[model samples]
Target chain A: NETAKAELGRATWKLMHTMTLRYPENPTQDHRDALESYFYLTSRLYPCGECAAEFQQLLKKFPPQTSSRRAASLWLCSVHNEVNARLKKPAFDCANLDATYDCGC
Target chain B: NETAKAELGRATWKLMHTMTLRYPENPTQDHRDALESYFYLTSRLYPCGECAAEFQQLLKKFPPQTSSRRAASLWLCSVHNEVNARLKKPAFDCANLDATYDCGC
Candidate 1:
């Protein structure tokens, strides 16, 4: 179960990071809504109930920063580092976030 | 670029399918809304613009069926088969939907 959970987490993170990285630099209100809504919906429908609850709590604390691509990606990176800390995993260097996930879009 | 797109595609599908499979058998209105919004948001925010446009078209043709777990899963499977056909890939066996994606949740 732990293995499956970890694998799912990795996949989910990949998708989220890639999507955020690809977000429009100067998005319209609609684009911002879509991005914010996506995160909330993911929290609700995540396959792992425990992870879903944790995400919901995180959302309450951090909310989603969708003003621009830089803000959104950095916000996610910071949140991911929070998760890493809780899991006793090494923190990702947020400075290299842009270099880390290249969707080649 | 193609490699990144393919990798992103696989991760997105894995997350989507597992989320649908784990959807409640008798979901509340909020849950239904969350599921529906997730798909639409995905269409708008997908990392691959071409793929996102294609998904938006498919969504227009066949909107997300979030009434129940069975409906949601079957709808996704059918749509995935549509993509497989487009890519000249073999169709997945939808009959084994539950058996195939064991998230070990």
Candidate 2:
């Protein structure tokens, strides 16, 4: 169960990070709203109840950074690290995010 | 790039399958709408352009079977197999779906 949970977390994170990385550099307000709504909806519907609750709380505290691709990606990286810290996992260097999450899409 | 794309695909699929498996057994209209909207939004915002196009086409063709958890999960399983066949991958036994995707959440 724990393994499944962790795997799901990793996959969700990968998808989200890649999404931000590929977000339009110069986004319109619609794009920004879409991104924000996507996150909230994701939290609302995430399969894991506990994780969803935690994510909702995180969203309330951190919100989402939707100004630009770099901003969104870095904000997600930092948020992920916060989750990592809560899980007693080592912090990932935010600087390497671009290289790490290049989905080549 | 292909490797990254494939990895992203696997992760996305995992999250999606687990989600369907955990969906409400007797869903209300709101739940059904949310599930359908989630899939549409995911295809729209999927980072990979080609994959997203294919997904959109698939949605149009198959739509979402949102009446119940079993319907949703089986529908997703069949859709995933369709993707696998297109990619020349072996078909998965749909009967084994519950065992394969126990997220323990």
Candidate 3:
């Protein structure tokens, strides 16, 4: 179960980080809305109830930043570091986020 | 790029299917709303622009089914099949969905 949970977390984080990295540099309001709503809804519909609740709390503390691709990606990177801290994982360097994820798109 | 896109697709699908399978058997209206909005927002924010547009079109035609866990999972399976067909991939057997994905949560 722990393995599965960990795998799911990694997969979800991969998708989220890639999405933000690919987000438009100068997004329209609709684009921003979509990204913001996606995260909130993800917190609600995530498979693990406990994890979902924790994410909801995190969102409340640090709402999603959707101003632009860089903002969104960095915001997500910071948030991910918070989760990493809770899990006793090493902090990910937020500075090299662009080099970190490649969606191959 | 194609490899990254395919991997992202696989991860996203795994999370989505797992989440649906774990959905409340008798969900509240709020739960239904969350699931529905998640799909819509996902289509809008998907990293692959072409894939996102295709999904948005599919949503217009099929919409999301959020009445219950069974309904939601089956609906997603069917939608996924639609995608598989377009991509010339083998159709997934939807009969054993509960056995197919395990989040270990």
Candidate 4:
């Protein structure tokens, strides 16, 4: 169960980071709203209740950054590091994020 | 890139399947709406353009089944098999669904 939870986290993070990386550089208000709402909805519906609660608290503490692709991705990386810190996991180097999540789409 | 894409797909499927598995047995309308909207948003915001398009088409062909947890999971499995068929990947036995996604939450 712990393994499955961890795997779910990894997958959710991958999808989110990739999403921000692909977010339009010059987004319309609609795009920004979609991104923000997506995060809230995700936190609300995430399968893991504890993680979802943690994520909701994270959102309250550090609301989603939706200004641009770089802003959003870095924001997510930092938030992920927050979760990692809580889990006593090693931090990811944020500078290397661009190189890390190429979707090849 | 393809590797990243494939990994993303696997992760997404895992999260989604687990989500349906944990869904309320007698969900309220709000829960069903959230699930349906989540899929739409996922298709709309999926990082991969081609896959997103295909997913959109799939949603049109076979809309999300939100009547019950079992209904949703099986519908998703069938849809996943459809994708696997197109990719020439081996089909997963839907009967083994419960055994596959145990998210020790």
Candidate 5:
């Protein structure tokens, strides 16, 4: 029984290691969309609040470019959801899910 | 069960402090492509033959990623894997999954 306990302990250890990931359960349809949204946002790396403000302004400034305008929704959400697993914070709140990104980031 | 074995050994020390992640099972991709690879390369800093060869050549030239590469994988397959448990690696390894990293930097 001790031997089996040891073996089960070892396996649990391995799974815990897997959970360190910061995002979501991932590889899901929603997870994929969220990741895709995140990649685009991180790629943008808007350097200032003005850039973010300008992001929303563009639609109003040039309402004709609807595709870019539509993308803003994904951008807002991806920017909000947050994860600080290194912080051992709650794991489910989608870090890149959108406008919820905390200043604690 | 030993108070459920200290809450299953602190939940198996938080699931072996999580398999300590590497180059797989991540968000669809990374930002820098380089980070898409490994910030720590705890995964593929290279197992050796060129860069891995020079790693092989360099390590064979100089040999071993040293206190470094190749065998950390071949080596760590220990208590977590076999024969090295009495070595009580994870009592240390429980806090150490070094060679395996999110590497995505």
Candidate 6:
């Protein structure tokens, strides 16, 4: 069902996004099962502004993150945004307290 | 030699903690070069209340985070606090704009 896809997308996205900042390089395939399950949801879904924005933010916040991690975060941020957008809810903010994000750039 | 360990500890601590929130499983072998390089520093260093506090906060904030990630966040937070405390700076806040953290809890 479409609803199932939507729910699965949301769940995986959340997991991926949350893992990214913590395991950036690669989650050592720890989440392969979850990733495999969500393949359909990810493929069915299209990219939107929120996902795009999160991709941009992830790039800004974790420049050294692995491709898998980036993709996961981007995917989650998009779906997270999609559902929230429907409800007209506000965007999520994880603003760092530091002036600089400590990118070591 | 001791000072070098401290510097290494600080750098790796930052890397590990950031990754923990993003990739809560394992950071793969990509950062192994750095992690192995800093093993001596991490082992040589002792935990203080600051590190202990950060560890507690990490547990609170990233309930789904892995032990390794939690340890890294805790170490970074501890050292981060120690440095910030020395400078008399404010706490770092990555507050979400939403009332709920959306942990889906």
Highest-scoring model, TM-score: 1
For each candidate in turn, the TM-score is 0.98, 0.95, 0.96, 0.95, 0.17, 0.24
Q: Number of backbone collisions per candidate, in order?
A: 0, 0, 1, 1, 36, 13
* Candidate 3 lDDT tens digits, A25-104: 99999889889999998998899888999899999999999999999999999999988999899999988888878776
Please give, for residues A1-105, the per-residue lDDT of candidate 1 as tens digits.
Answer: 898789899999999999989998999999999899999989989999988898999999999999999999999999999899999999998889778789886
- Candidate 4, residues A1-104: lDDT per residue as tens digits? 78778889998998899899998898889888888888888998899999999999999999999998989999999999999999999999999987888888
Candidate 4: tens digits of C-alpha lDDT, residues B46-97 = 8999999999999999999998999999999999999999999999999999
Kindly list the per-residue Cα lDDT of model 5 for residues B1-105, writing each as its tens digit.
Answer: 234323433443232222222212332333334232221221222211122222222222222111223232323333233322433434345234543322222
Name model 2 segments beyond 4 Å from true.
none
lDDT per residue as tens, model 2, B1-105: 899999999999999999999999999998888888888878878999999999999999999999999999999999999899999999999999899899999
Alpha-carbon DockQ of candidate 5: 0.03
What tens-digit string does per-residue lDDT give for candidate 5 at A33-96?
4434433342232222333354445433433211332343333332222212322444544344
| Candidate 4 CAPRI classification by DockQ | medium
Model 2: per-residue Cα lDDT over A74-101, one tens digit each: 9999889989999999999989988888
Model 5: CA > 4 A from native? A1-105, B2-66, B83-105
Give the local distance difference test score of model 6: 0.39
Clashing residue pairs, candidate 1? none
| DockQ top scorer | 1
Better model by TM-score: candidate 3 vs candidate 4:
3
Give the per-residue lDDT of model 6 (tens digit) for A1-85.
Answer: 3443344345444333433433334544534333432332223221232443544454444433234645554544555565577
Better of 1 and 6 by lDDT: 1
